[model samples]
Target: MTDATRVSPFLGLPGAVEGEGPNAGAPAHYGALVAEQRPLERGGAVVDLGNLGVIRLRGADRLTWLDSLTSGLVRSLAPGESGETLLLDVQGRIEHAAAVLDDGESTWLVTEGTRADEFASWLDRMRFLLDVRVERADEIVAAVGVFGDRELGAAAPNGVPLVWHDEWASTRVGGVSYATTDAHPGRDWDLHVHLLERPALEALAERVRVGDVSAAGIDALEALRIAAWRPRLARDVDSRAIPHELDWTRSAVHLEKGCYRGQETVAKVHNLGRPPRRLVHLDLDGSLGALPAAGAVLHVAGDPDRAVVGQITSIGVHHENGPIALALVKRRLDPEAVLAADLDGEGITAAQTAIVSPEAGHAADVPRLPRLGRRSG
Candidate 1:
């Protein structure tokens, strides 16, 4: 569990609003949330991710051991390189996701603070005779998120800046994209995570306070994330979530990598079947003057009495796109269908845009063979 008593220095900045729930221990927004978003999207500001959990791994077997367990190709990751990986269950359901950065001597995994302890505990159980040693480094290091290619003077612990660049903007090597669209919104998404020590974090906070640097809150960052159709483990994942449903294979899963815990399921689903659900981007009706609450049931727009087809996972009012949301709907749902979210007794209409297409999966495209039958010639 995350330390509830831990307070971030970013919270002391002018117009800062303390976050709650999953965003606890961080600032939700500054006084001007919408205003703050524009700067962040343009790479003019940074978001404090100090609340995120950091885990450090040491020893010679660290990289190779991690490669055999997760869903990414990480054994060859060079020092200062960034990688995204997922820990999946035996059934191929997502268990954890991390932004990975290695510094030659030590490997760092930055993940949701709420799941840190459980993630670390599981890693410990799997370390039978490996040379690796896992330790929770939350108290020793923190993370900050930068929106673009701009540098923020990140700390270099082993002569390499401890930064993890997100690979969302393009298809990763050995990864396949599930989105059928020619232009992907994620192509414009540029995010970087910088790890820093306590003194550096405090110094960076001071820079924001004196107007020497700019800062945005998690709210702004979230809005942009939703607009980009990015799926976060904490928000978009459920008990049954597989990487395919969220199109995570584009970044986190290497299709040709050697077997891992869930390799069979991942291979079968990609070659012979489709994900049960598909992720979609929604343009919500803002005329009602409210955003649909997370987990609100969704139905076909004109028929509120119809069976629920999906639920809202993440919702935000984007600066450019008024009200937007990311949802996981039944795989068979029509891509052009108009949807509605049940807010109380009222239905707020929404236009659906496919992120993970209904046609996703079955990548191998094997052809059917003719069946032999007994006959007299």
Candidate 2:
């Protein structure tokens, strides 16, 4: 394995397995690993999530202020709804990716893990005259991601207090005061967000019979995200990666909302043309036990020795498909481009490839409706 894909010595056990591959145990490959270890009969076990950020939006201006600050149309969200948003700079680069959850009284912003305190404080400072408040929720709540079994999926319902009873594992996820049965038996699962219950969460984290789960580290999680064709922040994008470039204009940006930073650039580029690079998935066509390193050039087959496309950002070996990878290729490059290269003396080859098809970039040049509850003279 190259330095980029090298298994870290600091990580141990289950973390090692998840961090070792590109799928990070989310794709079919990781699913197989879970089967071998736990050998599930009715349900399957997924990885536990920790790399996420949580923030609370309070005060009277919570909804209006957040609507103005983020890319999504937050002003229209109802009590039980959740919307994804992006924080973009004036130059159109994304600073953060957030999932906003409305709970009638307040709003929650869950972002990819970063300096939670710092980000919350920075957002607070931006509120100046607006009657809005921001606070870090990392200390107040601990999160666990669970994906499998649609039957148990509703454990974390949108509007009500989270509660479940699945024999071995059951729990509650929210600000409510309640206890739950252990419904999780290493099967179809749900992400648990225990509020103001740090000790209980930690204790539960220990008792859960999840083997090889701890092995899936942040690196592995990233691999699974890429394999799933999910967009990641820094790896796939740079300071110049606008929402449109990431095909995130629809999911993250609010085209019909009032002006915000980067709105002009977003409007102009979107209306006039498409971004230069696009995020794509690749099936490496070689026996490389490890996948390609980030930023490794994808030399198209016919044009050997010349790079018609860019290199990889994420990679992993699949259970059914073998070696797989994700990269930001030049949009004009052929979807049928024969990707070939060598890593650590292993000849890397890829056949299958697909682009993430998000909604077309927005045209913000169109006039938007007035924002509600603006400070009126």
TM-score of 2: 0.69
Estimate candidate 1's alpha-carbon lDDT, on a 0 to 1 scale: 0.88
lDDT of model 2 at position 352: 39
RMSD of each: 1.8, 11.4
lDDT of each: 0.88, 0.53
- Across 103-164, the per-residue lDDT of candidate 2 in tens digits comes to 67667776655445556877988999888878876555544433333222221323543221
Per-model TM-score versus the true fold? 0.96, 0.69
Q: Could you give candidate 1's per-residue lDDT for residues 1-377 as a string of tens digits?
A: 23644567888899888776677667889888778899898889999985588899999999999999999999999999999999999999999999989999999999988888899999988889999999998777788898777677777889999889998999999998898686998899999998878788889999999999999999899899998888998889999999999999999999999989898899998999899999999999999887778788899988736889998999888898889999999999988899998666778999999999887895646785556774545
What TM-score does candidate 1 get on C-alpha atoms?
0.96
Give the C-alpha miss distance for residue 191 in model 2, angstroms.
8.1
